[model samples]
Target: MNKILEASLKGEVLVIKTEGYLNKDLGQDIQDAAQEHIANGINHVLIDLEQSNIVNSIGASIIIELIEQLQETDGTLAFCNLAPIIEKTFKIMGLTKYCSCYSNENDAIEAMS
Candidate 1:
């Protein structure tokens, strides 16, 4: 199934919740959403990936792009509730070095705060 990306603002952070597979199209959708929020001066971001278990290389690349964008503005991006396999994939791919991963939303929010 196609991925669904839902974004909302929480205080100064933009929270993005994703479901289904994260492929190129959905990755672009995520990127667009992040860019829009950044343009609006909301820099910190939290991505909840509990329901997104699969991510293609293109999607991963898009995430890297988002990280770069945030870093340029000294903003932060954190991921929470990642599936085990996806979390491992991110670690193996060294994404965790750039963006942090949390066990839950509360932890992520606290750290970002």
Candidate 2:
């Protein structure tokens, strides 16, 4: 299951908190919400993964897809509260080269702002 914790505006940035699994099944919804907010001119974003785990390759692909979309708009996406396994996975996949990760949501928010 995928849950959108909430969407908030912090100055010029947009923070999107996601809970639960991120898989191909939930990819579209995630993309939709992000695009909707980006359409409103909220570009910078922080995704909090504090409550989620178990992201498969498909999930990672979806996240990459979202990253591509955001990149096209010159927007940024940062991740927070990532598990060690997921963090390593992301690093191995070269995601860390493009996206930033923080120890906590507050740090992520600060990084984007």
Best of the candidates, TM-score: 1
Off by over 4 Å in 1: none
Tell me, by lDDT, which candidate is best: 1
Per-residue accuracy of model 1 over 1-113 as CA lDDT, tens digit each: 65556798877878898888888988888888888889988889998988888888788888999999999899999999998888888888899999999999888888898
TM-score of every candidate relative to the true structure: 0.93, 0.89
* lDDT per residue (tens digit) for residues 1-113 in model 2: 58778777878777777778776765555676788788888878777778777677787777788788788889888888998988988899988998999999777777788
Each candidate's lDDT (Cα)?
0.87, 0.79
* Regions more than 4 Å wrong, model 2: none
Q: Tell how far residue 85 is off in model 2, in angstroms.
A: 0.9
Model 2, position 102: C-alpha lDDT score:
94
Deviation in Å, model 2, residue 109 alpha carbon: 1.2
lDDT assessment of candidate 2: 0.79
Clashes of each: 0, 0
